[model samples]
Target chain A: MNPTKPTDDARKGDVVSPTKDKGWFYTDTVKDHFFHPRNFMQDESAYGEAAMGMVGSPACGDAMKIWIKVDPATGRISDMKWKTFGCGSAIASTSMMSVMVTENGGMTLEDARKLRPQNIMERLGGLPARKVHCSVLGDKALRAAINDWYRRAGQHDNIEIEQGRVIDATLKITDKDIEEAVLDGADTLEKVQAKTKVGTGDPSCIPEVENLIRFYKEKYFGAE
Target chain B: MRDIYLDNAATTALEPRVLDAMLPYFTERPANPSSFHSMGLRAKEAVAAARGTVAGILNSREDEVLFTSGGTESDNLAVVGIPRAYVAKGRHVITSAIEHPAVLEPLLHLQKKSEIELTVLPVDRFGMVDPAAVVAALRPETVFVSIMYANNEIGTIQPIAEIGKEILKWRKEHATPLPYFHSDACQASGACPLDVEKLHVDAMSVNGSKIYGPKGVGILYLRRGVALDPLVRGGGQERGIRAGTENVPGIVGLATALSLARQEMEKENARLIALRDRLIAGLLAIPKTRLNGHPTVRLPNNVNISFLDIEGEAAVLYLDAEGIYVSTGSACASTSLDPSHVILATGLSYEGAHGSLRFTLGKHTTADDIERVIAVMPGVVQKLRVMSPVNLDMKYFA
Candidate 1:
């Protein structure tokens, strides 16, 4: 789609700005979710009993914390709430993710865990190229919350951890660490190296590090 | 909704007077200046009169000014054109790190092609480039120095006159006319005094849009004997430096706008400074907000502030909804997610740079507009902060 020109749905007053094309780059679904976010936790302290998962950091300009209430009997997420410190994309992604998990009497923890950034992005009529990383936060935080729930319930073996190590030696730099670096606004190889030192020690991992940077950048911020 | 525009630094509404001055050129006087007919002579004369008006503002010779299509083209002509003309004399060039991409990109292109040896001097925390540093960077081969009169994003004004004096002293001592000084005065058109004679600059750039004139027109002041290779080659327009058909309407509007800006500069700056200070003070009053750029030695109409833990783009959108127009560090609200390079150059972290906001006042901006922004900002910021995941204490865990 030509992102510069406003679509019919975009011109239908969903956007409040006088600049008609301000949110034209975004899909109608993305704009809808951004303007009217669902399951946004206005008061962070209100969800005390919910299992929480956090990702990204304020130092990098985008961080998100998701709270989920799981039903012990059915392993379903009964309620979800989140707070995000980022752009419209990050907030909308988390809001959409929360609604997706809890709607229709909620989804099982396993099904929620199966949900990917791609899935959330697809539901939102696709995000802008640069905001794909913003969508990634929702799934990662959801997985972390699910893990936290399992840990609190003493279900140690049920906790699923996706290990992603970019370098093979004692200097533990994982792909997740690189993703975090990208999320923290490290858009270049030099910046990512400064943040994670991923390939400084292991020259063999440099190519892979470069590849991962490209991968995540494309995954999060690339044109659909 | 009552709309309050504070993004004049990005672009300003065309003044009615400027528009009125340009209307005749577009409608009645639509003749090619190149044509020898009476109508064309009238068009040509109008252009010359506008040129004289611009020259008057800069304290320059009327023939010294060359019209182009705004600041970017003027910048390109100076940065790329000067080097191409002076390559035999030297290949080294000097510039500041915080210049607009129009200046930096062309220089970078030259460097990438191995056409020039480039040295980018760093700015202080307040975004001021030191004169001593510029002097130190000079070499026998250094051909040009392009520094901005004032930064667009941060609003910090450079001491162009001081830097010019230092360069002149160096040239006299070396007995070589090697390094020519250029300043992009696009943002400084109305807010700062720009006398090329007083500043001792060889070349300077100005655009019409920033001074409430028409867009798509700019002026590059090339002092006598400072030769630059033409960027656009056509019918020998702009003294063979920039060749194209003259934008008569745009030129007329530009000249009118510049003359008006120069005449009203003192009064306008004082009024803007008061409004700017009030906006700045009110914004800084918010908890954990740090003012960006030089506190006092900045543009009278510019106010840049960073609100911790809240995204600048989000705040901008929120403020836009509240009928207050502002801009953020984000790149045109597009897919490019990198934070502002200008903010980062000042030793601010990526987060701080990304979360920064710029509010640039203009002629129509009133005290009430500033107050409305001040009143609405705190609440918008609070709402975003409440929604932010970053704990004020700086602790995050999964």
Candidate 2:
């Protein structure tokens, strides 16, 4: 398993990594899902169908999409598909997720919540240390997709979610605009506030003002 | 299959001879070099001999060399220490836009403590910092100017001696204390000659890992009149600049590696230069490919290019599948999806930045390795381009 020498059993896409000799390290189970990525597309015309596409997170470094179709008759999953914009483990985990749903004959909201990263990795031999979270995203994405399906079916009352913090926004303030403002005697935070006619609405204006304040604070005065 | 390692700027394989030299220090003659006993005496002699060996290569006195954990710590000590020590004289510092984070981040941290003004000079498309621009950017309060001897990513060699001359002239005319200049020569150590006096720098940071030694050892070369505020406390090792028990094996390996690398430099650099050119030529032969760094002024061992309409990560993974290891940009910062600051400073577009890959050759890299990359690269780029969001037909290069 030493990386300096080639392994006799080395195959395409096999990662014989630093931890390879340790039996705990991952094998190439991702090939099954990568070559034949199962449930790759959604049922476009199904009833009670919903889609959720998520991009980067602090935890997982890439994006993914999940679509679920619920059968109103059985109150269960009719069909589901996922498209991943991430690592090999992400693709494999999502592929396995579709199979898990199929085997279960659709998912109950409780069953969907029970889905874990460990279950996906166990089925896929195991994920690499850094990529364990990549598989975790599939389960989270599945729950989100199912929740979206429930919401579309007017079942929002069953879920509880917390809202993130909100702050004032600003607009139309580019780096060039800030530079021009500084040139026009906006050397301090108070000067910038007075000079630039920026309001708390557009997303770009606040960050620009903050950067000016930061620079001025470092140079002539102190940060607020 | 065997993977070809082309990320020498990130780290290198430990040289066997250096490892052999370090073994006795770790096993047979283990003792604290700071102690006064017989075992300690021998250990102290070993350290002094190692210091002399490294000093010979840089043409500097052994007393000037202060060991640290690695390049980052060395840089932190040089940038923060000099500025903090000389704050009463001036608080401004100047550096280039294309310097490694080792130099840039510490300067950024120093900005928080004092009324410090940091001027990051811009670079041309080739990532070379102009000496004249540096002079123009200098202010009365500018106390230090930090720049890299060579770039790690695009491999552009900075005009270090020319910049040194400009700074000297400015100091003489103004009749002010000269700004201490520090260069992080970690990447440039083995690739280029590290003559401290000829470069006319106050301090320079050198890393062992880049020169085929173990990872945790480095040197900060502080010229005799350059004052520094100590970064660490307790035990009073590294001339009180850095305070910790000596990493004896790491230090021995570093000294051995530096001596060997300095000896073989000219021959090794020639070998790398030829291989690098071959890599660039093969890469450019493909359609819609643009070279990032200066063709001639760049490091002899570094080749960086951007393939239009292809995702760098996708191309990297494809190459990885073929047992050929390369990088999208600086290996240290590549974990983040944002394109490298070095690439962006060269005035490449965000897409252009994302499309870039750096292949840094080393002492181990061969013509065969270049040939392997040449054979596999075009196909990898083509496959990734076909699957990419942007159409390859659109010309993106400026």
Candidate 3:
């Protein structure tokens, strides 16, 4: 049971209210999954014959990997588990995703592949807006895992690679290029341009290029 | 459930003695010091005495101490006002990267407006600013230098007196008093030495809340003949440096708290150092754990450590569940989605900064509390680490 907290003065992280015991910024369902994550994979080596999906990075704030075993006889998920190096929101999101994909004799692989971050948010009573971007990278992680499952399951036709948003329409530089540039130690717009030639042809997309650099830096390097 | 408070660096609860001294001024003799009545005279007298108390601790004149709303305003006044008042001399300013945002943000805003050319000096791995580096950054146009007496995140004490001596010698060589030296001593007020003359700082900012006094009250000590443009423009109060109706109660509480702190400084510092070391040693015993700030040069009550593989927000929340309160430098814990600037400035990897936790001892902290933390923290870290996907090398950046 949760300790009753006064909701009158709840700021984004106002856990220490004036008149009550400490309260969490997250909902009770979110805290439950964070503290007691369902089907958490403590050691991956023991899980045996599962496809894994990973996103973000362990070096940064939010990163996670999910593993699932498909029941070949029924065409449903037999086991679902995850490991994460993220905040309360990210862990809860992934935990809820694992639960949703496998509960009640498991959902079919086609159904699990269609799951989105919004569905996870709705199930956990909606995540904080600030967390929606970083924490829900779990949705990307899950999609990667399902794609891996398709390859591992010999359903090669079902594997779908992500085509990230295009920032430079002229050079056809996608946002993934920007992320790779940041991971390769390119922090500034000029450095990213030097590496990827992003926005070289379409100078008008400079602003968008700058925004993507900042986003990738925060997502991959935790830079302000 | 066990309850313990360890986040003293963020803010402290008011001392009962401080609250006792402030009670009468609030409900009993409530009158503006500006009014020409007997009650007003008493209020004025109280404010003057509080000024004297703050000045006495800093070894400065009562006239030099200007009271304000709190540390932020005091910092704003010193960081912004000092350069502006001396702008005719030059338009250059210097500060350290590890300085509190109260000092850093204002200087940044000034630079953004092209009001001044700013140079942000870097710090060492232990978050110590180099005095020589500071001196090297100074130019003929340098109008001001601001650095904190102690850092809020890591509790690292800057070599302010050494830097002060360098600055004084530089001024002598250059034959110019263009660069005014300022220090934000809010976190340093009660724990460290704040004698302005010994430190050779032209100005210093001290806060009430950080010293176990009432919040919303602070003082800016401007050395004699040091001119600063006023920040708050109203009523020409505080010698025109800061203006507004004085917070008589908060001010009185601040003075009392500082005096109490001064009286007990030696004994309290000794007690806290013993407990702090015990906490640090216990935490470092964990595999892949590292301390954040300087080993011995930090505040007596501060203990900051990074637990690898697990994020700081998760640690803080899990500790909170066990009724042990603390704070962290992780981006996950921040609304801005960035880790602590102080931690980053110390050259910590993103993983290290995200995993950093700060536990500050205070008047209420005890040996049992430290023991409880040592006991609870290991299990918490193990739980989080087992669930985490990370296998950090401790040196990897991304």
Candidate 4:
């Protein structure tokens, strides 16, 4: 069976109908494309496509990606689309956003920030209370993409400054070099020495070296 | 259409025969079993006879059976009762990672009162707990080892007999000192074989509702001489382990239901196993479909599958629209926003767990029902997948 064809009884429909209020509190709409989702995919290497990748807490049940083609000359979005992998509400919400963005002549980056869950759900006719978060995912994805655009544009200097301490401390040495050294059969001390360029004499790199060694041991050998 | 009823795990439709057996207790003979009159004595005899039926099913002594309100009460009495009785022997207890909250929560509560150390062993992807892990977790202070006979959600049966033998070996090695063992056999009562002596569990919990009986009734078979504290301090009805007014009607129904289920066990298991396999085969044939539990060792009627690009709740709704009902996870914890702990513990992403559905079978489930779901699921999943905003490559699901 194709599993898509509605059975005759289902299509014939006058099955015991619920009271009007009991009718579907919400109706599903194929407002956004699912497989070849409307405006999905990104030209990852496109010269100026504003791209955002969002990873939802697996605890919450979905994640999304949003991409926008912006014409820097006019500050107006040239194309906007989203890809959300989640519940019906989530898919519908993201789809609704894709439709809204394209239908209304893509929002100027600033206008996109004001999008709300209700606006998207209302646009989609209405999502059940339980599915309201689906709409929020779409809104959040758009905002995140915009933020990513601004960040890449170097417009959020304060954020970059505030995050400086973490950046400097973690990236003081490239983590990849440390990982590679361990994988190449280097001993803990040797790997740390090679990556940090600090001899075993330096007490500061001791903890970092120990942690890196421990991380590798646990990851590769199951030895904590 | 009738309201969709997917909460069969919490309880079940009362079998007509079981219901008939209890009508006299409610109306014609409303006599307290404790009463000295003939009517009361008759009720007492019913309880005794029911005990025999329940005991016969488990292959245990009739006196070893203690009827309670249901699985929750039985679990509390077993997990909390036996441990408290032997608190002086040791304070450590062993259980599994995927226990029903009834077992997990009570064990946690017991930890508060005494210096009881708790070790929760983990389960593998198939939801099967390693018996060797249980043996390893047993310590000199280990008072009891509790593992559920079968996982309620994923339907994975544990190597319980092996665990029991290992515990016995430890007891002999330590010279008459070893941890007692308990298993919440609620899910396995009707679906699988449960020979207490062969399994070597000191105690086990069984619920009537899960086996097509009336709710609010169940039993905990405490191997004679196992000490335990009473969770409910009241009329001292259940050998002082559980204190409550006896639910005579419910007990009669539970006993009858158990007998009926036991008689039909083999046939029912084969029937549902065929149906469940068909459902799994159908779902797996669809693109992006993944089976969430073990293939051969799972519950005969449980088929939990995840559609990668579609949300589980939406799939459930679509199925329900066409008169099929199912669940997202454990019915007890469904109201919570988070995905199932068991699924998460199996290392699935929240999206993966959320996009999962559990289709459980019962005596009434038919091939047609499975076909109905199989027919609608792929299309529904496809529709939702297309709408999903996740930029999954089309080929991934197509």
Candidate 5:
């Protein structure tokens, strides 16, 4: 859990007290990017391809809004910027993501889209094992941003969709909605229904919804 | 390094005077209080004196102050032990939604075991259970009620005495002695008036650590008739309710610390309240920030605020860098990323719960410390808000 180097943590006289056990939260690299985030998209009125890449429920703790400016002829991400309503690691991870793509003469859209959470974690030294799950939203959001850039350029073939099987025909709620609801602490079918209105408009999806709830509950939370 | 501690509700730095009181027991008197020899008697005398101190403060008998490991243990013994002891009377228990996990978890475990029926009463937007509502929730089968005197996260001081008085009235009217009231006064120990008589509680828990005492020491003030089934069994200690060799040094420390707290509570509370209000005023001045608990009917030492449009851990981290220490109810601070149940119970949304920061004042806190926090807090909040993608709105909160 403590990925912070011993020498860093043992710098006992630093502002961050050794007794504070901050080393357990994130590595110094992560904290650096967190405290001083880079490429934060303060004004994103133009980046309208939104809500595709996010860390948490809007009702909960984390969310991210990412935008990109890609050069079509050069096939390069000329700029990348993001804003996150997230934890330190989430902000740091997003900041690091922007830097990764746009720093030292930017990476191409082709290279940027290939980025994974592991790559971001590696570059950020590493997030805590716990933070690795919820806080590492940068790579996923970056891929979504790249996809958005492709959409803006009208290159329909370039888009990579995170497809979800539609569950509720009337409400257009999908299996992904069920999964998200479960992640937001909707463990049972009734709670999922309450949150997503699943199996309500179309009672035909009721059995499938129950099964999916069971599956997702087991998937995210394990056999509880 | 500049070090400022504002997380006293989590735990306080041990008072030197407390350590001074315990030094002899820790170093010279190594015998267990259970032993019968001279050295054992010395340890026994220290333990008994601690008990006497606790009893005197709570207005309970000396024999009633049963020392345990800490607040968690004291709470567990009351919530878990009392219910099981009076199982034959009936098997229903009551508690608030915002109780510490120590009380809630054990009662939930008992419920899960099919041993007791449980009712969790909800709190208002102020994170206070209406005294009338609590009285209304009581049932004939209710063997116990464990409500915290002050919430850990929000620091809303409960109307424990009012609730206790209501319970007593109900018991007399119904001619039933089934329900025994217990208040977890771990957070309330130092600041609040904790006379068990005035509180009308059958049992109350007070911990050492929160009062600048040694950690790993707490006492359950069980009124004479209130029985408790043992949680830990060994040498038949604590009159068989809590069984372990007595912690002599820790006990002495707790007693010394608690005496100091009681002695200086009035003056300290005045100072802390002023500091706390100044902190609340300063933090709430920041845009989109709101106070979490009740403004006036809260603990004097506590100031909880929800800095909207930003994550709590981020705010906490930034504050840490500025030589300020505080706690947050944010999910990011937890291993499971679960938002605080206490803050959530106040009818704040998950977002608000995630952003809630609690700063608890203590003996060491000063006016300058309050001003320092006030000076630094807005900048931290503004920095995070500028970085956060979420739009500012109190609409998400009801």
Candidate 6:
């Protein structure tokens, strides 16, 4: 008695490719954003005046650069554009993020700052489990753009860099940071510890580091 | 809207003649070949005839042919089965890095279990495995060497004949009862010459899907005394090498398809090469695009190109939306998000690997299809490149 039964058309084998099912790995919304990305920067000339923020690298196989124009009077994001060289998840995540920031007369700088990857992922009906890291890239770049905006406006005091909840202050490693490390192919606690040096500075975070490794691995790879 | 199916290397539409030949076996003469009856004997004769047709195409003995489910099964039967059968003689195996996963995965699995020491010879920039490397990797303990006749992704044709000859020479000199040569010629059966004797391969794998045949049938030429531990053991079919009830219809379809392919291969190859070259030239006209494989010595039906800054899956999806079927990499490996290892082995950057696309032409592919793709591709590349985050001006990123 499954609630999500295959429709009559699917049962009839009318669907040529099994991957065409919207709910298979990615939702229809994600597919839509990936297929027809909105407010994508057409070229360098299109967003020449917008503040830009870049994250990740081509070598890492995912990179995102976001551009934003803030309304001076309301300090709201007046316009947004993005370019992403990554998989469907990263491209759709950034595309959805640009819409989220600029739609409905745009979000205020503070509201944009408060925006996290989860909000963007939710708007796109969630990404694949392993691709959750791609979602993290959007807000990180948004924050970078907001910082750039502050710097351009000579509002040094207004700029705020959100720091991770430091589990190891000496090594500047946090649980969230450790989770990102795990997402970046550190499938084991030892690998995570080696890459981020999460627990080396302070032995107390070792247990948390191990827990995060297990948590992320299970979350991404599905209990392998 | 007309759909142009360019992903032929993935699979092909079955020919009507092949389908007609298959129909009788399906409904009119459905019998278990192992049964001791007239119907069984008829089925057995049909299978034997099909085997003869396949053997004729490969220039091998009829008894040497063993039927399997498809290319993957045939490859597994050769790669894994050979090592398992002859491990006492040698624990080492050699294969090219650019082999289809059907060949590569089984060898890798055996390596992972420490059952065999696998030497994966790397390909050149054009995706061609060096015959010299295959020769160098040969050892007295090397029980098997498997390489693809042509790469499915980049479409680069390997020197399988030369490599096979070298393997034979090495075996002769060393007096080793080992290092059997196997070529996964699943992609080569339609366009390339595949006489097993001429190639000097101990065994060669062929499948129906690539040659306008049925999907469920494959043939492996075992070169008579070439030993293989059965991957599937059952009713002792295919000379106890592969065991299952005969798929009479599929076997018949495969034979008819291979016969048809061989008949028209010379003319079809020339037609496809012209179309392939035109498509490659037109696609490469787009700024910052590069052809992925060799210029002249590639499969006539294959045109793989990479655009700078954009992800290949996006380009493939865009082409799909335009009613043209293509692939970002091997269809078998498309579900994974990783950049193609074949591209990576060619010394392309990770970004370049991510930015590649494969467009394989088929028998039905025409000059009009190539023209349509050429007209539409530049816009698709421009759209994706505009959306790509990596700035090509950045030397390190590009």
| TM-scores for candidates 1 onward, in order | 0.88, 0.73, 0.88, 0.74, 0.87, 0.86
Candidate 2, which segments miss by more than 4 Å at Cα? A1-224, B330-335, B392-395
Give the per-residue lDDT of model 1 (tens digit) for B111-172. Answer: 99999999999998888999999998999999999999999999999999999999999999
Give the winner by DockQ: 1
| lDDT per residue as tens, model 2, B1-398 | 55799988778999999999999998899999999999998999998888998888889999999888988999989888998898898898999998888888888877766557789999998998999999998888888999999998899999888888888889889998669889999989888878888887889999889879999899999999889998899898988878998888888889999889888989988888999999999999998888998999989989999876655655666677787878876211233334688988988765566667889888888788899999999987765443322443434467
Runs of candidate 5 exceeding 4 Å displacement: A1-24, A45-57, A163-224
Local accuracy of candidate 6 as per-residue lDDT tens digits, B158-202: 888899888888888887756899999999989899899989999
Q: Which scores better on DockQ, 5 or 6?
A: 5
Interface quality of candidate 6 as DockQ: 0.36
Model 2 interface DockQ: 0.06
**Candidate 2 residue-wise lDDT at A113:** 59
Model 2 lDDT vs. the true structure? 0.72
Q: What residue runs in model 3 are displaced by over 4 Å at the alpha carbon?
A: A1-22, A163-224, B396-398
Task: Provide the global lDDT of candidate 5 against the true structure.
Answer: 0.80
Indicate which candidate wins on TM-score.
3
Between candidates 3 and 5, which one is better according to lDDT?
Answer: 3
Candidate 5, residues B39-78: lDDT per residue as tens digits?
9998988888888888888888998889999999999889
Q: Provide the lowest-lDDT 10-residue window in model 4 chain B.
A: B389-398
RMSD of each: 5.8, 11.2, 7.2, 12.9, 6.0, 6.1
Which DockQ value does candidate 4 get?
Answer: 0.20
DockQ of each: 0.40, 0.06, 0.34, 0.20, 0.39, 0.36
lDDT (0 to 1) per candidate: 0.83, 0.72, 0.83, 0.70, 0.80, 0.81
Give the i-RMS of model 1 in Å.
4.8
Candidate 1 positional error at A122, Å: 3.8
User: Model 2: what TM-score?
Assistant: 0.73
- The recovered share of true contacts, given per candidate in order, is 0.68, 0.00, 0.63, 0.49, 0.68, 0.62
